[model samples]
Target chain A: MATSEDGDFLPLTPVAFDILLSLLGGEAHGYAIMRSVQERTGAEASLHAGTLYRALARLVETGWIEELERAGSDESDERRRYYRVTGVGRRVARAEALRLENQLGAARAHGLLGRA
Target chain B: MSHRRRAVTERLYRALLLTYPEQFRERHGDEMTRLFLEKGVDARRRNGRAGAFVHWLSGATDALRNGVGERWNESRQSRREAGTPTANARRTNERGGGGMDSVLKDLKYASRTLLQNRGFSVVAIVTIALGIGANTAIFSVVRAVLLQPLPYEDPQELVLLWGELRNRGITHFPTSPPDFVDFRDRADALEDLAGVSTFQASLTGDGDPVQVDVGSVTPNLFSMLGIEPVLGRNFVEEDGLPNPQGALPGQPGVLPGIVILSHALWQQRYAAAPDVIGRSIEIGGGPAEIVGVMPPGFELLMPPTAALTPNVDLWTAARLDYVNSPRNNVVLRPVGRLREGATVEQLQAQVDLIAADLMIDNPIKATAGYRLRVENFAADVTAHVRPVLLALFGAVVFVLLIACANVSNLLLVRASGRDREFAVRAALGGTRSRLIRQMLIESGLLAAVGALLGIALASGGITLLLGFQPADLPRHRNRSHRWTRPSVHGRIRYRRGCDFRNGSRDPDVQVRTRRRIEGSGRPLHEPVPKADQERGRRCGGRVVARPADRVRLDGAELRGTEQRAAWIRFRRSPYVQRRPSVRPLPAGHRSSGFQS
Candidate 1:
């Protein structure tokens, strides 16, 4: 599922967790989101051209992401395609965060977080 | 599909199909491309041209990427399957240790190929030889004329100071002595200034008893050139003083003559004596003391105009009776080294100011001239010869171009014959790029052999030039014509009168010697005009080297032209008329028109 911050997480290649983490903020163009994801992760992750575009197409088709009508401006050289998270995308993102929080709490209860 | 449509479809299929690696291409490239095109065209009809382009592009890209990836993976897989122990060992060696092995192997193979194709190798070598030889010859001339440094310390600092006579509209002339003196005193940039003049001296006491070229110079001449005497010492300040009636200051009756010999003269005449200093020799009709010998290849700094031989077998400082000596005598050619941190332009500007001051003092000599300009010694000497050298280079380049065209045609023929071998190698996994590199290496090998032959040819050429050189060279730039031999004998023979060998016997010969006119300067032998000569006696000489019996003459005494011709007709005689072919002309020998 796609979310607002998923644009930022798009560049966190091959990692579903990092992608979800980055999409927590707002909508973005594909290239803009890829750059944001790379910057946030300190370049530790990079998305291949094929994989990134393919993932975007699949997300749009699944209705988790909605395409926005980008404003036509004099400065824009090409069709600046934009995307945003839909209602289903937001719901999926919240559920993912909750699932991760539960997993982390279990680890803390077992004392694994600070165990020597 | 019709044949045309099917052909078009196949073409489109082939474009996408060829993206596979060679290993895959041979096995299944055609089948895969056919399937992709069939599916792609149907998609294009439904989705549009842009859709079709994207679909085809993606298919081609994926195929290429996968094909290369599969090859790499398969090679790795085979290594594991075979459990090849040497694989890791070979990889370790290949990291650095075994690199030289491959280079040596390539070189050895190239050498073998060259050796096998002897005819092609020889022709290629000859072609390269001509190219390299022509280049070397032109470069040597260029080096002599341009590249080599002048024979002086910091030669770039040395400049020929010439006065431009602005009023007279003449550009360059030797600076007047007084002007040189004025500049030396006033100029702040000059480190040293000197002047030189040509004079002939009779080497009376020398073994050969001949005339030698002598240079009269100021005390600072050799110093300005940054040269030192190889023997004894250079001119001291005291040697420049003029003695009354050419008498030595200390030795009352004897003239105070001091002379410095050139290196070549010293070696030839003095046998390179160590104790050449303080030796007394008679020169210019006076006893002069040998002060020192100069280094070899030291030519006086002057433009070689009119083939004037360098009048400098020895050197002497100009005497100090200078107050009375007219500085207006524009004879001396001056050269000077500028001080460190001074450029030629700066020196010239400084000299110009000095020249202006002198112009005020002597309006006639100085008003006609502007500031002095400086020229480099090497450039001043070789500037005129540049055109001749360039012409020679152009001729040689034309020959080289012809040689290259011939070689290229030969190589193309050889390549056609070797096409079968190349095809076989290609089939056996050799790539096109590797084959081209091998052929280039073969060309390089041929070029190397040609270079060796070319060097030998160059040496022979230099020897030929040295052999028939004129007696007096360099001084006489037009010696080229005189240096040429008779077309038949290859021996240097001149017309009898201009021959220097007979300078003593014949006064006419002596006149020719003094003139030193080279290249067809001989006078034609003709009968003296009847009005110009008075008859004393009739002289007769035997006819030698007779021609065939075809005697014909014209005179007013004949009744008619045809009657005279009939009377003059003669039959072939049984006895062959012969005389001595070559003999010395007798002391009183004279020729007549009617020789019996």
Candidate 2:
């Protein structure tokens, strides 16, 4: 409950935020999340396998994400572990987006951005 | 992708993942491999093989950076928690509570105690000072006389070749010119050989005429010794050859009159003139041109006889008429440098064979008891002084041991008085080893201070010794008087004392002390004391007299007849009685005997 008001996670790493944004839709395995991040960032902020997993492990530790258990015996790829954003993770992502929007509005007031 | 290519790509990624830490690899190996394989297929589908390669490169770099970073953070965290271990556990694990910190504390405590007991401190310090001072002085003398190598190239290969008359019990008689030439030419083991003869020359030109020691050496002497003159050229073959036209206007059929000045004489007579070379000076009443100036500290080859001056002031060519000289004239000392890989025994064997051949060639010329003797040049120079030096060294070492025992006894008495202090310290949690260490540190501090004082005293002692050293003692200007500093042996003795004090009843300490005692046996093992005894027996009950008694004054006022009577009367006096044991035969008489 205090996560959204204090803005404790207002400054998320580009890769971590991107991973969170990619998992916003639904549960996805690690490889799918990496592809989604590359696609969403237009390949400007690509997350490699090692960087993705390291950030994923940290996010899970901070309670911003959780590993989802397999429900059925689909067993197509047993090696892949799925991950999803927790309720706190969704709030932190919304707070970070608001913080960025406020910075952009200030930049516009000072005419630091081109008219668009 | 083909199955084989996919398998190869998976294998490479797995190998790269192994670089991570064991805990990391175990938890994440399967997941990492699956992600990498899925990305590889997607990358190949999008951009082909090059895309897969790029993905692999980025992933590998990221893996390396994070893997190392994680392990570094872990170690830092562990180190931060290291101090939380229990005190007893830490004590057993660590060698000491605080290595350098404890030593500093001990040193502080030691100084305080020593200052508190000023009277005991003075006695212990003075005793150690005397012991260390005497040891240092004697060791310096021994080092100078025997241990230091001669100032020459390959000094060990240099030897003195003396002709011996075994039946007459004279083992070091000088070699005759013919015998030297024979050995030089025939002995394959000798690299080079030269002869030297000492002479008295009166220097007359620059100032008042003064008698100075001169060495008449063969032309090749400097070359054989591997020494070069500091100024001008060494003697050449032409200098030694007899000139049909004499060097001066009146003298006829004389050798080329060339002389090389020693550095001391050069400074004294010439006032170190730059143009001293090529200048004519009077030597033995004859005009001789100065060819060169030898460096300082150059000593001439001469027996350790007190009659001769300590050092040669000048050098000249022997210029012997080798072909016409009598074979029985044995006045020149032969010195030879051994060839590479040649042993003294081999050279001696060769010289003996040559002597036998010479004896057979001329029966009357070669004496019946003639033989060859080879001796190390350095050993021969210090032969007479080694015994007296070793004896002094032994005496000083014994005195030092007695001093050590006295100081140890004093320390024991003092320590007994401090029994209560130690008990109190133990009650305050001082371990047994810690208490022992504190005691050792106190003794070590005392020894260090004593050693510093001892060095100061030893330097003064050395200066005093050198002042009284005999002029004929072989010495060099480059030799440092402070060659033996009292550090190593003093520290060893201090260590032994500390061990003894710490555990008097410990069997290990007893064994260590015994071992140290056995290891520190006499350093000089030669029969030097026996040689001293032999010399005592040889010179016993003889009136020893100085050779200065033979100095005679010649002047215009004293006519020839009166002067001769005065000289004869002076010689016959009881004070100048002929003592064969002390006084060597006069120079002229000895040379005459050699010629006979």
Candidate 3:
């Protein structure tokens, strides 16, 4: 169950939404998440380094994501700080997806949105 | 890229990280630097040589933007959590906040706000800096060139004499040798007169052949100007005699007599040796002895028409035979000092009488349409350049005005968002004046930073401008450190002193000018002074407001132009007879000497 406080975090900003969706698949470092989001967005040539890091930091601070103790697969390299989404974050993502679906369904019924 | 280059790149990235908040830097600084290197490597491998450049450009911009954003958010979040307007500094003074402690807290808070809004602060500062930098640079030029007081004793008493043809629209032409003598003898209004002319001659017997600007001056010139040489003796009457080459350089006469070395030349060539006064150096193939060394920072400050640059390396007394000199061959540009209680108007009246006498006595003067005038030496030298400096100063002032408007607009935007903060302070017993004072503190902080940065930029810009060193820009190149406030004041005062002289004069001359204007069937022009334009306004005659350097109206396009008199420039020394290997100053180059 999504907490009311978690619902207050929605509807999500576009950058925050993209960042959460990318992190949900598995634990990943900043570069991997940046690459994944860039591939999905397909417009930005590459994700801005500052934008990716800032969003990741905010998500971790918000308790919607957790930074793992493991720095990277290469343990010697301290820079590859990795992160994963939390249970509350996953529930919130699902709730947002459902809400978007209901809005689209209403739009399609009203012919505001049409099937391609 | 080499390994060393990669190391430097990494270092630069680290330095850029300083813009981020300390907490953010501690948490992610290493990761970002590592990611940037890897990202750049990947980009270069995929996209060729330019790939690395693009990566650095985008990465730096991204870092700057996000660092500022994160800092803003940091401040915002802290304020939200604290749930109060006052910070640590203000809290210390919450009790009895009314004096020095209150002032200190206000300053601290103002600085804190600027630091928090890093992006807005940098943008505002840079905009103002650019405007002020440009203004300062232009001010440096105007200061050195047109606005500086002429460095001479009783400078106001000094006057420049010129012969003009009102009908021909030819003015400020140099005087002939005989004519100069005539003026000297006949003009009682003047205490004394001295002539100087510039020539490019070689120092042949020195270590190597070096080109130098030499001034041939009337021997008593120093005495008239109250200047004494720093070393050795001033030129005696004997040194004033024409060189052995008779009236001209190529004529059979003694080529060398005595020379005075400029202070800079003394230091450069002779190592400022005190015993070097009697040393003989061959000038233009003549054995010339150095009799004196001029004081440092002494150079002829004259108008471009006089063709005297401030850097003249050598001075020699002219030996002229006035009786035998041709009246039609005009060449000498003379400076005259008035007797005590004498005025330029008095000298002008005397000069006009002499010109009238010459027209009655000689056909050359009549045919040439001779008209004579005198100008305040300071006003005359700065005439052409003053307008240019004023325009540049005006332009930079406009730029500064626009910058101020932009900063005002930025402050308004920020203030609108800060209403709630102000409200909180007010509700907690802050008066309206206190809030205004706080706002003033913030603006004052911004101005201080902007002014400092602007001055730094100006110093660099002035150095760069000096490197280009346009020929007509006077007094500016040598004094690199002269960014003084007094120069600006001088500009304002100098403007008033010159304005009255430039106003309407001589209706007879104006009538001739009107006739000339009516005479020009086509739109042909020669250059006219800004003063002439002012005179033309009152005459109801057309004047080309901005004339090109290419002078077109010779004898007002009259048929008998040869009678207009040839201002023959004789290269007097046979050794100096050879044409300069380099080309003449390129077209559109502002010449300080008379140009046809």
Candidate 4:
């Protein structure tokens, strides 16, 4: 039951938004989320492993993310902690996407960019 | 990556992970290390060793920034939620509730109350500022001129020896070269003695022919003072002997033409050349070799008064022909450093014995009333200004006392008004000492603020006083730094007694003022009559009247009747008058009795 007040958190820090976007597909361990961020950004926004965990700790404190119970499997690394974005995190990510779209519209109006 | 490198990388990442806050590390330390090793391995596989190094570098920096930032934000949030107490309150509670805690609480309460009533704080602070500022300024001057040790080794043993005529009431007369030589050789109590004289010399061949004041000192002057020249050598014993025949083109019968340039003169004329030591320069139309450059601010032997220049620009060796110089030609001023364990009285007794011997040997030259007077060099230099400085010191101290009394009275009134509050606290089991402590804390706060402002005022006040100070005032630029220590100690003592039982009736203040007033009056009453008699003797004595306008040294006009009077006084001595055929040569050409 994410409230509309979650929309007020539209301006996510770039790294935090990228982390949330990486977790959007599914629950992922810290390494998978870091690798996903690098792949999606063409390795331009590679989050260091320590930096990724610090952001995750802040995101958990803000209630925008949660650590999930790791499934016990023979190949799974016992040290890896898996995280998933909450419903509020997803809603705030959507609000941020909308805000970016409006900013793109304003830039297009001023002839600073073209529609892709 | 190789297994060895990978193992090292993993260990390094684990150490870096410890930089995070303890709680965060506990939750994610192992996970963070696993991810780092995975990234390092991936980077090494993709790019190579440089890629892994870059990854660690960027990762360490990022972790440091974000980890510290997160902890700071967390603590700030908790503080906001808990409504954190002020620093004073935290200090009190952290001390575990005792006398210190109560004092801290009282200080906090007093500061807040004073802030609410700003007018009283400002007035009291301003009053104390003026008082403390004036006192500090005068104290610095007095300390520098009177109390501070002279810039010499074992300064307490240093003294000025003057030939005094007790019957004529004439004290502090100059010494003759022969007498000085005799005393230096005969005196057992003195470690060493040196004579210094000041005169004008012309510096030519460089810039405009500028007349510079030169000091002619004995070879032992620098060694006696325990100072070395910044470059080259001090005046060696050989340097003081007359130059051999045909050593220089001009100035026949002159001492070896060697000069030690003052630091200022070296910079001005030679541009502080490293080769200045061996170079030759024309002084008074004679080429003199530069033997040394004195260190900067090395002014222990400056003339007490000079008209053309404030400081001596050069030093030369005083080569005295004791055999030819008359015993009564009293021209050199002798300064001596006593040997260890030798008191002034012992030196005085030795000096008296020597004076008696000289009188018996040269009965015509040495008057019956002649005696040797030994005075501390610092006292002799500062005797002229001691009265003025003492008076100003007294006046400022009185002002500080008045200001303190007024502030104490104001605090008393405020404390009386807070009687009901104190009574209420006492009803709650607050002891009498606690109430007094609170009052004292309030006074301490006020005094602290006042002292801070006073120090600020004093810095500016000293600069202003120095700016307008008389040209002849004995100036020491580092004096104000010395004032800070004693004034701070005084301020602490002031605060200790701020709320003592007799705060309103400080007997010490009354007694200090009485002593200072008596001290100030003594200098004015006692010294004035003696100084007046001395001045009358100089003016009305049988010395020849040489007009100041007629006296010229190296084309520089000697100004004032005082200079002329001094010159006449030196020349009219029994020995100089006895040699009537010998004319008094200009200072630069004189064979003996060189004045610096």
- The candidate maximizing TM-score is 4
Model 4 residue B579 CA deviation in Å: 80
True-vs-predicted CA distance for residue B245, candidate 2, Å: 10
Residue B252 CA displacement from its true place in model 4, Å: 4.4
Candidate 4 regions off by >4 Å? A1-4, A29-54, A70-80, A100-116, B1-116, B205-207, B243-256, B269-287, B301-310, B340-343, B364-368, B383-405, B408-449, B467-471, B481-483, B486-596
In the range B39-74, model 1's lDDT, one tens digit per residue, is 456547767777666766665566656554555554
Candidate 3 global lDDT = 0.69
Candidate 4 lDDT for residue A109? 89
Docking class of 4: medium
* Residues forming the 10-long window of minimal summed lDDT in candidate 4 chain B: B587-596
Question: Can you write out model 1's per-residue Cα lDDT over A59-98, one digit (the tens) per residue?
Answer: 6665767667764243651444556777766666666666
With candidate 1 superimposed using the best TM-score fit, by how many Å does residue B353's alpha carbon deviate from the native? 3.3
lDDT of 4: 0.68
Q: Write the per-residue lDDT of candidate 4 for residues B87-107, one digit (tens) a residue.
A: 433433444433443566678
Poorest 10 consecutive residues of model 3 chain B by lDDT?
A: B541-550
| lDDT-best of 3 and 4 | 3
lDDT by residue for model 2 over B1-596, one digit each (tens)? 78998798788877877766677678777788777777777777777778877877777787777766655554455445655334432452265644554577778888888887788789888888888887887677778767888777788999988777777777777877777888999999999998888878787776799998888889988877878989988998878774453255337645446899999999988888879889877788876788899988887534474133557899987777666567888778888999999999999999999988987887753655788888888888788778887898898877776666566655654653343355444444455667677788788888888878887878787877778787656753334546345766566557545533533223353443444234433222222234333433332211222223322221112334564466456445554444455433222321111100
Poorly placed runs, candidate 2 (over 4 Å): A1-116, B1-102, B205-208, B243-255, B305-308, B361-368, B467-471, B476-479, B503-596
Ten-residue segment with the worst summed lDDT in candidate 2 chain B?
Answer: B587-596
Q: Which stretches of candidate 1 lie over 4 Å from their true place?
A: A1-116, B1-122, B166-172, B206-208, B244-255, B306-308, B366-371, B390-413, B428-437, B462-596
Which residue pairs collide, candidate 1? A5-A23, A5-A24, A6-A23, B213-B311, B213-B312, B213-B313, B248-B254, B248-B255, B248-B256
Interface RMSD of 2: 1.8
Candidate 4's TM-score: 0.67
Report the lDDT tens digits of candidate 4 across residue range A1-116. 33568667867888889988988998888878888888888873268866788788878888888987865244666666778899878888778877788898899988887654
> Using Cα atoms with residue i matched to residue i, what is each candidate's TM-score against the true structure?
0.48, 0.56, 0.53, 0.67
Counted clashes in each candidate structure: 9, 0, 8, 6
